[model samples]
Target: MYARPAHFYARILEAPLHFARIPDKAAISHAGRLQREKKTKELKGESDSTSKAKPWVDQDLQDDTEIPSPNQGDDEEDDPGSELDLPHVPYAPPRYAVDSMLERSRDFYTLLNQRRSVRFISPEPVPREVIDNVIRTAGTAPSGAHTEPWTFVVVSDPDTKHAIRTIVEEEEEVNYRQRMGNKWVKDLAKIRTTWVKEYLDVAPYLLLIFKQTYGIGTGGKRKTHYYNEISVSISCGMLLAALQNVGLVTVTSTPLNCGPRLRVILQRPTNEKLLMLLPIGYPSDDATVPDLKRKPLDDIMVHI
Candidate 1:
């Protein structure tokens, strides 16, 4: 075999590192094909992973239903008030000394502590003005995006109240026997509650609270009511407090799977869903309460 020339060896040394390792056309084509296949697999894997992942939260809590936004159309102008910056007003509440604050807090707690859910409500008429004021206080609760998506339907007519009772009883009977599991029924046994809700007819007023899932805007387009359920829940807390303050009594009742029927009977719009049905009045002379204690603050609260 002939030995390679010194110049040839020098040329090889001078060549680029990549040029020295240049593959044949077939080898290069095969590598390119493999790379394309790998990328396809990666993209497919990514799609599958996304499709298989669970939702971040429960479907009921997510309120995933979409509403057609009023400003979505090209011809429609965006609502100017929604985007306008509002001027802030100064807020100054009266301040109290430390001892006074402590005493006030204790007194408020004591007053609220006396409050109880009384199933036996008196049929004596409650002043309409008082109910109005209590509901107005509830409306002061904070809401997401300031939507204030709550409605208080106060029913006083005897026939309408009875109709509500009929609907509630029909659904609650099924809930007790089948919908609510055996464990739930057994647990409620201690409270001596059943499907029978006589207070619905006996009470003087039935306040059916509804949450507006969406609102109508200009041109009849639907606008989103963000976190409507949560907003209404906060308002209900204030309403309950107000009721307690006025020496009135009520039992917060949520009729299971009766929203549609109650909504129809009450002649409410389709956008609204029933959240709570409270029969409000004075407690009966024979009204008795279950002996229950609330959890301690330490048990319920966490401080970081």
Candidate 2:
């Protein structure tokens, strides 16, 4: 005569709830039949879901049960494997339009060839804007690894240019007297180069080109650059061509002891190596160059 909980009494009144005394053998048989029915229903549901999700089967398997094909719409004729056998279209060629200004290439070459180093420059001042444009033009030159490793330092201050000239002349004097020796001097004689660097001060701008030996990374580690010499030379050539193209005269002047003295004078880092010192400005009225001749095309060219 124990009282049941409220939930237990309510569940007993439900129509689905039934209790009966049965033998152990009959109870076991009823449980086994129920479990078999539940498992069969679960397996059927899984197979149906898998078939709906993945209709395409592996090539090794054949579809035993036939199904209606999807391309049954009869407005137009259709091939069963048309989607899988679509043709691939090739890419079209790029369009290359000729530039109108390209006609001046020959004239530009002639103008550049006429440009010569004027040891004697006029004291006329050049516009800073012009120098900026020239440098920008030089930046367009192709470089090794596209790392345009060059620095153009323009010194327009009279005092700074004068000081630089003094340092350069001192080095040049040593080079001509002691370093270059007689043979080198004789070879340079035809060009009429000397230790007197008066053009450095007279020119409106002194562009000192420096080549970076290597780039500094994090933690002060150095990364070696490829084709540093060739890259710097090409950049210098582009700069010279740009200056000449804009109707400005330029003289490429290289002085000895440039690496040490100029670095100290310019207060540059050790990675920056001095390559060429260009004195750029208008030439004097009496400026002249040697009558030098270039090799003919036939002599310079070879064909296989």
Candidate 3:
């Protein structure tokens, strides 16, 4: 076999070392450029992207540093593990319990069962403190991954209520005339719903429920939340029960036009998705609800 020249062997020995140095040199140069850009932005009174980008880059750098070189031998002294030190944390089980009272539960269920979908509400003003207390009760609901993703906005100002009513009526008019076909109108015929939303303005308070689709953690990273819709719905149920328990009447209004309009009117953050708008107040002195009956327990329940 023919042997390579002495210069060829020299080139082989130097190539690996040069290739290894190239990555380190590139990393250092990139770090320097990032620092320079950060400084330039600071001097110009502009926010630097470095602070926002550093965590990701730093993590990558750390991963790269942990990787052993291809030429490293088993006998060579290993790098110290100080960079990868993880503190020992003691394990502690969660300590929380729910107190169940059968009697109270029975009464609560009974009260909720009496709640009717009131449409003809009185203009009597509901106390602000009552609404606040109801919201506090709702905050105790079990939520997805313990992320209490719900917001209740209580609007009481007459002008704001009037504005909401106008916007809602405009949308409802279009819905009744054009959007909602005859079959849809027929289905709602017995319920007696109208395009004119006088209740929006007449009600003492409009409770807007928002469901947080995602939570913003520290540094604005989105944290995943579980059962966001179910959690919000559960909380809303508890809120309605609490409101009824306090002797205040409420109507769960679902004007198809209200969701988008309320989103614009409230200027809510994008993370918060609108759920439903509830008009809450006292019923009129002579207010009357439809004489409707609910399905029997046997019909709704199945014993498996």
List candidate 1 segments past 4 Å from native.
Answer: 1-84, 179-193
Winner by lDDT: 1
In terms of TM-score, which candidate is stronger, 1 or 3? Answer: 1
The sequence of per-residue lDDT tens digits that candidate 2 reaches over residues 1-304 is 4443333432211211112223475568666765665677676774423332222222111222212234222222122122223334466875545663455666787887788877778889889999999888877766544446677788898998998988888777676767446565565564236777788889999998877655554444443334455677787888888888877887776566756677778887665677789888888889888888887879999999
Q: Candidate 3: RMSD over Cα atoms?
A: 21.8
Candidate with more favorable, higher lDDT: 2 or 3: 3
Candidate 2 residue runs with Cα over 4 Å from true position: 1-102, 179-193
Residue pairs with backbone overlap in model 1: none
lDDT of 1 by residue, 179-229 (tens): 446564565564335777899999999999998976677766655455677
Q: Tens digits of per-residue lDDT for model 3 on 86-112?
A: 444467875534444666667777988
Worst 10 residues of 3 by lDDT: 11-20
- Measured against the true structure, the TM-scores of the candidates, in listed sequence, are 0.72, 0.62, 0.62
Clashing pairs in 2: none
